[model samples]
Target: MSTSSIKFYDRFSKLYPIVDVFLRPQKRRLFEEINLLDHGKLLEIGVGNGTHLGLYKKHALIGIDTSKSMLSKAIDYATQEMQLLHMSGEQLEFEDHCFDYIVLSHVIAVVEHPEKMLEECCRVLKKDGSLILLNHFTPNNFLGYIDRAFQLFSPIFHFKSAFYLKDLKALKKIELKEQIHFSRLRYFKLLIYKKP
Candidate 1:
Protein backbone atom coordinates (compact mmCIF):
# COMPACT_ATOMS: atom_id res chain seq x y z
CA MET A 1 0.00 0.00 0.00
CA SER A 2 1.19 3.49 -0.80
CA THR A 3 1.60 6.14 1.88
CA SER A 4 -1.25 8.12 0.36
CA SER A 5 -3.43 5.02 0.29
CA ILE A 6 -2.75 4.42 3.96
CA LYS A 7 -3.59 8.08 4.66
CA PHE A 8 -6.81 7.74 2.70
CA TYR A 9 -7.81 4.69 4.71
CA ASP A 10 -6.89 6.37 7.96
CA ARG A 11 -9.21 9.21 7.06
CA PHE A 12 -11.91 6.72 6.11
CA SER A 13 -11.50 4.51 9.15
CA LYS A 14 -14.13 6.25 11.23
CA LEU A 15 -16.84 5.33 8.77
CA TYR A 16 -15.52 1.89 7.84
CA PRO A 17 -17.46 0.15 10.57
CA ILE A 18 -20.73 1.62 9.37
CA VAL A 19 -19.84 0.81 5.76
CA ASP A 20 -19.10 -2.78 6.74
CA VAL A 21 -22.69 -3.33 7.76
CA PHE A 22 -23.71 -3.56 4.10
CA LEU A 23 -20.91 -6.09 3.62
CA ARG A 24 -22.22 -8.49 6.27
CA PRO A 25 -24.39 -10.56 3.96
CA GLN A 26 -21.54 -11.15 1.54
CA LYS A 27 -19.21 -11.92 4.44
CA ARG A 28 -21.66 -14.52 5.69
CA ARG A 29 -21.92 -16.07 2.25
CA LEU A 30 -18.12 -16.21 1.95
CA PHE A 31 -17.81 -18.37 5.07
CA GLU A 32 -20.71 -20.58 4.02
CA GLU A 33 -18.94 -21.33 0.73
CA ILE A 34 -15.72 -22.47 2.44
CA ASN A 35 -14.74 -24.71 5.28
CA LEU A 36 -12.46 -23.14 7.94
CA LEU A 37 -11.49 -26.01 10.20
CA ASP A 38 -8.64 -26.55 12.62
CA HIS A 39 -6.02 -24.90 10.44
CA GLY A 40 -3.22 -23.92 12.83
CA LYS A 41 -2.14 -20.52 11.60
CA LEU A 42 -4.58 -18.24 9.81
CA LEU A 43 -3.53 -14.90 8.37
CA GLU A 44 -6.03 -12.35 7.13
CA ILE A 45 -4.53 -9.79 4.81
CA GLY A 46 -6.15 -6.35 4.92
CA VAL A 47 -8.22 -7.22 7.93
CA GLY A 48 -9.71 -3.75 8.10
CA ASN A 49 -11.28 -3.47 11.54
CA GLY A 50 -11.07 -7.05 12.74
CA THR A 51 -14.76 -7.48 12.00
CA HIS A 52 -14.11 -11.04 10.95
CA LEU A 53 -12.05 -11.89 14.03
CA GLY A 54 -14.87 -13.90 15.55
CA LEU A 55 -14.96 -16.18 12.52
CA TYR A 56 -11.43 -17.50 12.98
CA LYS A 57 -11.39 -17.90 16.75
CA LYS A 58 -10.43 -21.55 16.42
CA HIS A 59 -7.18 -20.75 14.67
CA ALA A 60 -4.11 -18.77 15.73
CA LEU A 61 -5.11 -15.55 14.02
CA ILE A 62 -2.95 -12.79 12.60
CA GLY A 63 -4.40 -9.71 10.95
CA ILE A 64 -2.47 -7.21 8.88
CA ASP A 65 -3.45 -3.80 7.55
CA THR A 66 -1.68 -0.68 6.34
CA SER A 67 -3.84 1.92 8.04
CA LYS A 68 -2.97 2.74 11.63
CA SER A 69 -6.47 4.02 12.33
CA MET A 70 -7.99 0.81 11.08
CA LEU A 71 -5.53 -1.28 13.08
CA SER A 72 -6.39 0.70 16.19
CA LYS A 73 -10.06 -0.05 15.71
CA ALA A 74 -9.22 -3.68 15.12
CA ILE A 75 -7.29 -3.79 18.37
CA ASP A 76 -10.33 -2.56 20.22
CA TYR A 77 -12.61 -5.08 18.55
CA ALA A 78 -10.31 -8.10 18.36
CA THR A 79 -9.70 -10.61 21.11
CA GLN A 80 -6.30 -10.55 22.78
CA GLU A 81 -5.23 -13.71 21.01
CA MET A 82 -5.50 -12.11 17.57
CA GLN A 83 -2.24 -10.41 16.53
CA LEU A 84 -2.64 -7.20 14.58
CA LEU A 85 0.24 -6.02 12.42
CA HIS A 86 0.65 -2.77 10.56
CA MET A 87 1.95 -4.12 7.30
CA SER A 88 1.52 -4.19 3.55
CA GLY A 89 0.46 -7.30 1.66
CA GLU A 90 3.04 -6.87 -1.11
CA GLN A 91 5.92 -7.25 1.32
CA LEU A 92 4.89 -9.80 3.89
CA GLU A 93 7.48 -10.37 6.62
CA PHE A 94 7.10 -14.08 7.17
CA GLU A 95 9.04 -17.23 6.52
CA ASP A 96 8.31 -19.21 3.36
CA HIS A 97 5.42 -21.66 3.57
CA CYS A 98 4.61 -20.83 7.19
CA PHE A 99 0.89 -20.26 7.10
CA ASP A 100 -1.70 -23.03 7.03
CA TYR A 101 -4.28 -20.74 5.50
CA ILE A 102 -4.37 -17.22 4.07
CA VAL A 103 -7.45 -15.10 3.62
CA LEU A 104 -7.92 -12.06 1.40
CA SER A 105 -11.22 -10.32 1.98
CA HIS A 106 -12.04 -7.50 -0.44
CA VAL A 107 -8.32 -6.74 -0.64
CA ILE A 108 -6.85 -7.75 -4.01
CA ALA A 109 -8.63 -5.05 -6.00
CA VAL A 110 -7.17 -2.30 -3.85
CA VAL A 111 -3.59 -3.56 -3.74
CA GLU A 112 -1.05 -1.64 -5.83
CA HIS A 113 0.35 -4.82 -7.40
CA PRO A 114 -2.02 -7.73 -7.13
CA GLU A 115 0.39 -10.18 -8.75
CA LYS A 116 3.28 -9.28 -6.46
CA MET A 117 1.04 -9.50 -3.42
CA LEU A 118 -0.24 -12.89 -4.55
CA GLU A 119 3.32 -14.02 -5.12
CA GLU A 120 4.10 -13.13 -1.51
CA CYS A 121 0.91 -14.86 -0.43
CA CYS A 122 1.77 -18.03 -2.36
CA ARG A 123 5.30 -17.99 -0.98
CA VAL A 124 4.07 -17.83 2.62
CA LEU A 125 1.29 -20.38 2.32
CA LYS A 126 2.22 -24.00 3.02
CA LYS A 127 1.80 -26.40 0.13
CA ASP A 128 -1.71 -27.89 0.18
CA GLY A 129 -2.92 -24.93 2.28
CA SER A 130 -5.85 -22.77 1.28
CA LEU A 131 -6.16 -19.26 -0.13
CA ILE A 132 -9.62 -17.81 0.26
CA LEU A 133 -10.75 -14.71 -1.56
CA LEU A 134 -13.82 -12.54 -1.21
CA ASN A 135 -13.78 -9.79 -3.78
CA HIS A 136 -15.60 -8.00 -6.56
CA PHE A 137 -14.10 -8.78 -9.95
CA THR A 138 -14.94 -7.52 -13.42
CA PRO A 139 -17.30 -9.74 -15.37
CA ASN A 140 -16.33 -11.11 -18.78
CA ASN A 141 -18.63 -8.93 -20.87
CA PHE A 142 -19.49 -5.39 -21.97
CA LEU A 143 -20.09 -4.46 -18.36
CA GLY A 144 -16.48 -5.28 -17.73
CA TYR A 145 -15.46 -2.58 -20.14
CA ILE A 146 -17.67 -0.19 -18.25
CA ASP A 147 -16.05 -1.40 -15.08
CA ARG A 148 -12.62 -0.77 -16.55
CA ALA A 149 -13.67 2.72 -17.56
CA PHE A 150 -14.55 3.37 -13.97
CA GLN A 151 -10.91 3.01 -12.98
CA LEU A 152 -10.74 6.77 -13.39
CA PHE A 153 -12.50 7.03 -10.04
CA SER A 154 -10.46 4.40 -8.15
CA PRO A 155 -8.63 7.05 -6.19
CA ILE A 156 -11.98 8.06 -4.75
CA PHE A 157 -13.33 4.52 -4.38
CA HIS A 158 -10.11 3.13 -2.89
CA PHE A 159 -10.00 0.08 -5.20
CA LYS A 160 -9.34 -0.61 -8.84
CA SER A 161 -12.47 -1.10 -10.89
CA ALA A 162 -11.19 -3.71 -13.36
CA PHE A 163 -9.45 -6.36 -11.29
CA TYR A 164 -10.42 -9.84 -12.49
CA LEU A 165 -9.75 -13.31 -11.20
CA LYS A 166 -8.03 -14.20 -14.46
CA ASP A 167 -5.41 -11.52 -13.79
CA LEU A 168 -3.92 -13.43 -10.86
CA LYS A 169 -0.53 -14.98 -11.74
CA ALA A 170 -0.65 -17.32 -8.75
CA LEU A 171 -3.60 -19.22 -10.21
CA LYS A 172 -1.23 -21.54 -12.10
CA LYS A 173 0.09 -22.90 -8.80
CA ILE A 174 -3.28 -23.49 -7.18
CA GLU A 175 -6.31 -25.57 -7.98
CA LEU A 176 -9.67 -23.88 -7.75
CA LYS A 177 -11.64 -25.74 -5.13
CA GLU A 178 -14.90 -23.78 -5.16
CA GLN A 179 -16.39 -20.55 -6.46
CA ILE A 180 -19.61 -18.93 -5.33
CA HIS A 181 -21.07 -15.78 -6.80
CA PHE A 182 -23.36 -13.82 -4.50
CA SER A 183 -24.30 -10.62 -6.28
CA ARG A 184 -27.28 -10.31 -8.60
CA LEU A 185 -24.93 -8.90 -11.24
CA ARG A 186 -22.48 -11.75 -10.53
CA TYR A 187 -19.77 -9.23 -9.75
CA PHE A 188 -19.01 -10.31 -6.18
CA LYS A 189 -17.47 -13.75 -5.73
CA LEU A 190 -16.11 -16.04 -3.04
CA LEU A 191 -13.32 -18.29 -4.28
CA ILE A 192 -11.32 -20.99 -2.53
CA TYR A 193 -8.09 -22.33 -4.03
CA LYS A 194 -5.78 -24.99 -2.70
CA LYS A 195 -2.00 -24.76 -3.12
CA PRO A 196 -0.55 -27.69 -4.99
Candidate 2:
Protein backbone atom coordinates (compact mmCIF):
# COMPACT_ATOMS: atom_id res chain seq x y z
CA MET A 1 0.00 0.00 0.00
CA SER A 2 1.04 3.57 -0.67
CA THR A 3 1.50 6.20 2.02
CA SER A 4 -1.50 8.11 0.72
CA SER A 5 -3.65 5.01 0.77
CA ILE A 6 -2.68 4.31 4.39
CA LYS A 7 -3.37 7.91 5.30
CA PHE A 8 -6.80 7.81 3.68
CA TYR A 9 -7.82 4.72 5.63
CA ASP A 10 -6.50 6.13 8.90
CA ARG A 11 -8.36 9.38 8.38
CA PHE A 12 -11.55 7.76 7.15
CA SER A 13 -11.65 4.92 9.66
CA LYS A 14 -14.58 6.55 11.43
CA LEU A 15 -16.71 6.52 8.30
CA TYR A 16 -16.82 2.72 8.22
CA PRO A 17 -20.04 2.71 10.25
CA ILE A 18 -21.91 4.36 7.43
CA VAL A 19 -20.23 1.99 4.99
CA ASP A 20 -21.18 -0.91 7.26
CA VAL A 21 -24.87 -0.16 6.93
CA PHE A 22 -24.81 -1.13 3.27
CA LEU A 23 -22.26 -3.88 3.83
CA ARG A 24 -23.81 -5.74 6.76
CA PRO A 25 -26.35 -7.61 4.69
CA GLN A 26 -23.73 -9.09 2.38
CA LYS A 27 -21.38 -9.65 5.28
CA ARG A 28 -23.98 -11.89 6.89
CA ARG A 29 -23.29 -14.52 4.27
CA LEU A 30 -19.58 -13.85 4.39
CA PHE A 31 -19.53 -14.42 8.13
CA GLU A 32 -21.74 -17.44 7.78
CA GLU A 33 -19.25 -19.03 5.42
CA ILE A 34 -16.35 -18.13 7.69
CA ASN A 35 -18.07 -19.34 10.87
CA LEU A 36 -18.53 -22.73 9.30
CA LEU A 37 -14.91 -23.01 8.21
CA ASP A 38 -12.62 -25.46 9.95
CA HIS A 39 -8.98 -24.55 9.61
CA GLY A 40 -5.57 -24.00 11.21
CA LYS A 41 -3.69 -20.71 10.78
CA LEU A 42 -6.01 -18.35 8.92
CA LEU A 43 -5.17 -14.82 7.88
CA GLU A 44 -7.92 -12.29 7.30
CA ILE A 45 -6.51 -9.40 5.31
CA GLY A 46 -8.03 -5.96 5.96
CA VAL A 47 -9.87 -7.03 9.06
CA GLY A 48 -11.24 -3.47 9.40
CA ASN A 49 -13.05 -2.96 12.72
CA GLY A 50 -12.95 -6.67 13.62
CA THR A 51 -16.67 -6.78 14.31
CA HIS A 52 -16.80 -10.28 12.88
CA LEU A 53 -14.00 -11.67 15.01
CA GLY A 54 -16.47 -13.31 17.32
CA LEU A 55 -18.06 -15.14 14.43
CA TYR A 56 -14.94 -17.23 13.91
CA LYS A 57 -14.87 -20.02 16.47
CA LYS A 58 -13.16 -22.97 14.76
CA HIS A 59 -10.14 -21.17 13.34
CA ALA A 60 -7.06 -19.43 14.67
CA LEU A 61 -7.48 -16.10 12.97
CA ILE A 62 -4.72 -13.55 12.53
CA GLY A 63 -5.93 -10.28 11.08
CA ILE A 64 -3.60 -7.80 9.37
CA ASP A 65 -4.09 -4.22 8.19
CA THR A 66 -1.95 -1.30 7.05
CA SER A 67 -3.79 1.38 9.02
CA LYS A 68 -3.08 1.96 12.69
CA SER A 69 -6.47 3.54 13.29
CA MET A 70 -8.21 0.51 11.82
CA LEU A 71 -6.04 -1.80 13.89
CA SER A 72 -6.90 0.20 17.01
CA LYS A 73 -10.57 -0.13 16.20
CA ALA A 74 -10.12 -3.87 15.79
CA ILE A 75 -8.34 -4.23 19.12
CA ASP A 76 -11.50 -4.76 21.09
CA TYR A 77 -12.25 -7.84 19.08
CA ALA A 78 -8.89 -9.49 19.83
CA THR A 79 -8.96 -12.74 21.70
CA GLN A 80 -6.86 -15.79 22.48
CA GLU A 81 -8.16 -17.29 19.27
CA MET A 82 -7.46 -14.19 17.23
CA GLN A 83 -4.43 -11.89 16.84
CA LEU A 84 -4.40 -8.46 15.27
CA LEU A 85 -1.28 -7.24 13.47
CA HIS A 86 -0.30 -4.00 11.81
CA MET A 87 1.10 -5.33 8.57
CA SER A 88 0.75 -5.03 4.82
CA GLY A 89 -0.98 -7.75 2.86
CA GLU A 90 1.29 -7.09 -0.13
CA GLN A 91 4.31 -7.92 1.99
CA LEU A 92 3.46 -10.38 4.71
CA GLU A 93 5.95 -10.94 7.57
CA PHE A 94 5.39 -14.63 8.11
CA GLU A 95 7.46 -17.54 6.84
CA ASP A 96 6.63 -19.45 3.67
CA HIS A 97 3.64 -21.75 3.52
CA CYS A 98 2.71 -21.12 7.14
CA PHE A 99 -1.00 -20.49 6.97
CA ASP A 100 -3.61 -23.13 6.28
CA TYR A 101 -6.13 -20.63 4.92
CA ILE A 102 -6.02 -17.00 3.82
CA VAL A 103 -9.12 -14.83 3.72
CA LEU A 104 -9.00 -11.75 1.52
CA SER A 105 -12.24 -10.06 2.39
CA HIS A 106 -13.12 -6.81 0.66
CA VAL A 107 -9.45 -6.00 0.30
CA ILE A 108 -8.05 -6.88 -3.14
CA ALA A 109 -9.19 -3.70 -4.89
CA VAL A 110 -8.29 -1.29 -2.10
CA VAL A 111 -4.57 -2.02 -2.07
CA GLU A 112 -2.00 -0.25 -4.22
CA HIS A 113 -0.97 -3.52 -5.88
CA PRO A 114 -3.67 -6.14 -5.74
CA GLU A 115 -1.51 -8.68 -7.54
CA LYS A 116 1.34 -8.24 -5.11
CA MET A 117 -1.05 -8.81 -2.24
CA LEU A 118 -2.27 -12.02 -3.83
CA GLU A 119 1.28 -13.12 -4.48
CA GLU A 120 2.07 -12.66 -0.81
CA CYS A 121 -1.09 -14.49 0.18
CA CYS A 122 -0.18 -17.38 -2.06
CA ARG A 123 3.41 -17.40 -0.85
CA VAL A 124 2.41 -17.77 2.78
CA LEU A 125 -0.36 -20.22 2.14
CA LYS A 126 0.34 -23.96 2.38
CA LYS A 127 -0.03 -26.01 -0.76
CA ASP A 128 -3.60 -27.33 -1.00
CA GLY A 129 -4.71 -24.55 1.38
CA SER A 130 -7.74 -22.44 0.54
CA LEU A 131 -7.80 -18.72 -0.23
CA ILE A 132 -11.18 -17.13 0.38
CA LEU A 133 -11.85 -13.92 -1.47
CA LEU A 134 -14.85 -11.70 -0.82
CA ASN A 135 -14.73 -8.81 -3.25
CA HIS A 136 -16.64 -6.77 -5.84
CA PHE A 137 -15.51 -8.08 -9.20
CA THR A 138 -17.11 -6.28 -12.12
CA PRO A 139 -19.43 -8.14 -14.44
CA ASN A 140 -19.70 -7.75 -18.22
CA ASN A 141 -23.12 -6.11 -18.02
CA PHE A 142 -24.44 -2.60 -17.37
CA LEU A 143 -23.57 -2.87 -13.71
CA GLY A 144 -19.97 -3.29 -14.79
CA TYR A 145 -20.12 -0.08 -16.77
CA ILE A 146 -21.45 1.67 -13.70
CA ASP A 147 -18.52 0.36 -11.70
CA ARG A 148 -16.15 1.45 -14.44
CA ALA A 149 -17.62 4.96 -14.33
CA PHE A 150 -16.88 5.12 -10.63
CA GLN A 151 -13.25 4.22 -11.37
CA LEU A 152 -12.68 7.91 -12.00
CA PHE A 153 -13.43 8.73 -8.37
CA SER A 154 -11.81 5.60 -6.95
CA PRO A 155 -8.54 7.39 -6.23
CA ILE A 156 -10.37 9.76 -3.90
CA PHE A 157 -11.86 6.78 -2.06
CA HIS A 158 -8.69 4.59 -2.18
CA PHE A 159 -10.40 1.59 -3.84
CA LYS A 160 -10.96 0.36 -7.36
CA SER A 161 -14.57 0.34 -8.51
CA ALA A 162 -14.14 -2.02 -11.43
CA PHE A 163 -11.76 -4.78 -10.41
CA TYR A 164 -12.13 -8.06 -12.31
CA LEU A 165 -11.19 -11.54 -11.15
CA LYS A 166 -9.37 -12.20 -14.43
CA ASP A 167 -6.94 -9.36 -13.75
CA LEU A 168 -5.53 -11.25 -10.81
CA LYS A 169 -2.18 -12.67 -11.91
CA ALA A 170 -2.06 -14.90 -8.84
CA LEU A 171 -4.64 -17.10 -10.49
CA LYS A 172 -1.73 -18.81 -12.22
CA LYS A 173 -0.84 -20.50 -8.95
CA ILE A 174 -4.29 -21.22 -7.59
CA GLU A 175 -7.28 -23.05 -8.99
CA LEU A 176 -10.80 -21.69 -8.61
CA LYS A 177 -12.58 -24.13 -6.34
CA GLU A 178 -15.88 -22.33 -6.03
CA GLN A 179 -17.52 -19.04 -6.95
CA ILE A 180 -20.66 -17.88 -5.17
CA HIS A 181 -22.68 -14.66 -5.25
CA PHE A 182 -23.83 -13.50 -1.86
CA SER A 183 -24.83 -9.89 -2.37
CA ARG A 184 -28.44 -8.97 -3.14
CA LEU A 185 -27.33 -7.15 -6.28
CA ARG A 186 -24.84 -9.88 -7.10
CA TYR A 187 -22.17 -7.18 -7.19
CA PHE A 188 -19.88 -8.86 -4.68
CA LYS A 189 -18.78 -12.47 -4.95
CA LEU A 190 -17.20 -15.04 -2.68
CA LEU A 191 -14.48 -16.96 -4.52
CA ILE A 192 -12.70 -19.93 -3.03
CA TYR A 193 -9.35 -20.90 -4.53
CA LYS A 194 -6.97 -23.71 -3.76
CA LYS A 195 -3.21 -23.51 -4.24
CA PRO A 196 -1.77 -26.40 -6.23
How high is the CA lDDT of each candidate model? 0.85, 0.87
Tens-place lDDT per residue, model 1, 55-94, is 6647788899999999998887788788999889999999
Query: How does candidate 2 score on lDDT?
Result: 0.87
- When summed lDDT is taken over every stretch of 10 residues in candidate 1, the lowest stretch is 30-39
Best by TM-score: 2
Model 1 whole-model lDDT (C-alpha atoms): 0.85
Q: Name model 2 segments beyond 4 Å from true.
A: 183-185
Candidate 2 local lDDT, 84-141, one digit each (tens): 9999999999999999899888899899999899999889999998898888989878
Candidate 1 clash pair list: none
Weakest lDDT window of 10 consecutive positions for candidate 2:
30-39
